[model samples]
Target: MDDKDRELMDRYVYQVVRRLPKDQRDDVSMELKELIGDMAEEKGSVREALVALGDPAEFAKKYAGESRYLIGPLYIDTYWKVLKIALMCVLIAVFSITLAQGIIERYEPGLFTDLGSIIGFFTHIFSTTLSSTISSALGVFATVTIVFMVMEHYKVDLDEGKNVVWTIDDLSKKEPGSKANVTGMSAEWTPDRLTPVPGKKAMLPRGDSIADIVFSVIFGAILIFTPYILGVVWFIEDDEIGKGVMTIPIFNLDKWNLILPVFLISLLAGLTDAILRVIIGRYNLKVMVSSIVSGFIQIVCWIIALKVLPIWNPNFGNELRRFIDSEFGAMDFATYFDPVRFSNIILVLAIFGLAVEMIVTVVRTLRYGLDEGKAR
Candidate 1:
């Protein structure tokens, strides 16, 4: 009837309904509100109505019915949540180790000189890593599932002794959110414990993050192990024959070694960004900050790779000139292509691309995190 009474009634209804499954929450909430209102009218006060209903937790358990599985409904939510996190970590660790082993075993000096060799190299590594990861993944899933099942059977609480049994007083006070207070698994369930449903823009695609991880590993490997594989292929005109194909290495190995650290730092930053995206599964201020930092580091690496370090082969021009002169008389290779100018152009393009990515990340963060009020 009064504002305070109305507030108490709403809080009581929320406590009961929030314990139900997502599909049942809305229907049960409407039913609970109507029931509470009728009871309150008869009882002369909302407090009296709530007391007659008994503890919201126990009332919800009755509605939830009995469990038919090893893990009851009470522990099912937490079991799945913990299981997913554990499996993800296991997969990441397995995949990383397998990939590293394959790469190290296959990699050798001047191993990937051509496109075919490069493709084969990566294909081998990918196939080997996939094969190794599958068995490990199965084992991890089984182990995690068994652990959770045992916990459920034993009536184990993740909170241990921290959370006491729910009481009527809990309905009157809001508790701060804590991971230890998982719904159904602990006695700290409150309306505030419910997470906001993520908007479309807030969600990060797992596929994209996975692709980023694979690409970053491969690209970083290329930078460290096979920089010379990236090259310019040209044709020299020949009088006797039609033409001869020549391949010239793009990056100078000597100079590349010097700037390798900078390139690796950039790769590390990018990998961190991808890992965070996969773990969080949503775009927020933290993910936005990571993206910005990753972009900045990559831009710096590109500048160093293309400008500060003499990574490009200085002898490329003369080498092309010698090959052309042997057949077509005399030619100035600089007139056709200047590696320095090309490097500058690439640096500019790389910076532009990174800038665009950072802007998009910031915009998504604002739209999903700020506008939707779901920053977490």
Candidate 2:
């Protein structure tokens, strides 16, 4: 081979080697150089050597395959997997805390209230410090381990002889139906189309199932107690122990009117998101559909609660006097309908629904747009 050809081959190999993990880069470079040199000796020319080594693009692919535990082609290009796992951890922590608090209030009653100081004390400990560290460590470890394990299971090692048995360019140059052409074509095309991507078979833990309920209950208790502990400490610091003790009941007791709506919305959103993800397998569709559906449901519920509930009376004085003097005396008929108060309540709820829907719609649209842009 000519000096120029040799230099080109070395440079090409170096470029491929540079892409490999630092630990393996130098060794891979030396190995590739040796392999190319041996091929050149047998072929007797630089052009022949290059042909045997295969297309530079194809060669680079083969080089990557040498790593038995490569996460992905774009592993270095992006940290999306890391980000996703981190987000999941935060979600778990939040869910844990919320669920624990709810359960404690339900079953333990005054226990949570009495331990307000403990809850207050631990709120900062769990939310800000302990939860953050634990979640981060678990997220990173789990993400990395899962990615690498899946990659290895798929036999994505670059150095493996099976991956680079032949090249596409080499196959195209050969006559159709030739043994070399067939083998090369099969090797280059079949792996991607036939073999499912690593991690595709693995099942992610869903927060909707019985398992989630169990986890939430167990973790929720811990989180609820954390806040009360903190509250006690707060009271001690403020020199208002009596007020703090009284505040425990209000703090720990779950207000069904408030908690129910939020829980329903969140649960519905999560289910909708999961369903959309399964249907579309795209971020844009999942986010948009989930947001819209959840928002719509929330608005409908608000409307019903505002319009259907008979809790206010507009003309209390006149209606009460008439009822008192009527044949059906002492009946509380006027108390049933309060046009002024009812209208005000309905208006407030309607406005709230409208605002929520608008916010959700805008957010979903933006998320969809961003995802599409990324795909493009």
Q: Which candidate leads in lDDT?
A: 1
Q: Write the per-residue lDDT of candidate 2 for residues 1-376, one digit (tens) a residue.
A: 6789789888878777766668888788888788788887889876677777766766666766646335544232223433453345445665556544433433322334667756864564456555544665576667656754564567443222243211221221221222323333444433233322213222222333333333433333343345342221212113343232211221222333443444355445434444333222322322354556665665665554445543232334454445355434666654354554655776687658656754654565564423221212
Question: What's the lDDT for residue 368 in model 2?
Answer: 41
The count of residue-pair clashes in candidate 1 stands at 0
In order, candidate lDDTs are 0.69, 0.46
Worst 10 residues of 2 by lDDT: 165-174
Instruction: Write the residue-wise lDDT of candidate 1 on 1-376 in tens digits.
Output: 8999889988987888787779999899889888988999999888999999999988988887764257876566655654675466556766876685576556655555788879998999989989878987788678878875776666665444332221111211221233223234466555645446667777888888777776776677567655654675554455676444446776776766587788899888888777667655677655688799889888888887787788777787776677677657876644365877899888888899889988988998887754322236
- Name the lDDT of candidate 2: 0.46
Q: Which residue runs of candidate 2 sit more than 4 Å off their true CA positions?
A: 1-67, 74-136, 139-287, 297-376
Candidate 1 lands at a TM-score of 0.48
Residue pair clashes in candidate 1:
none
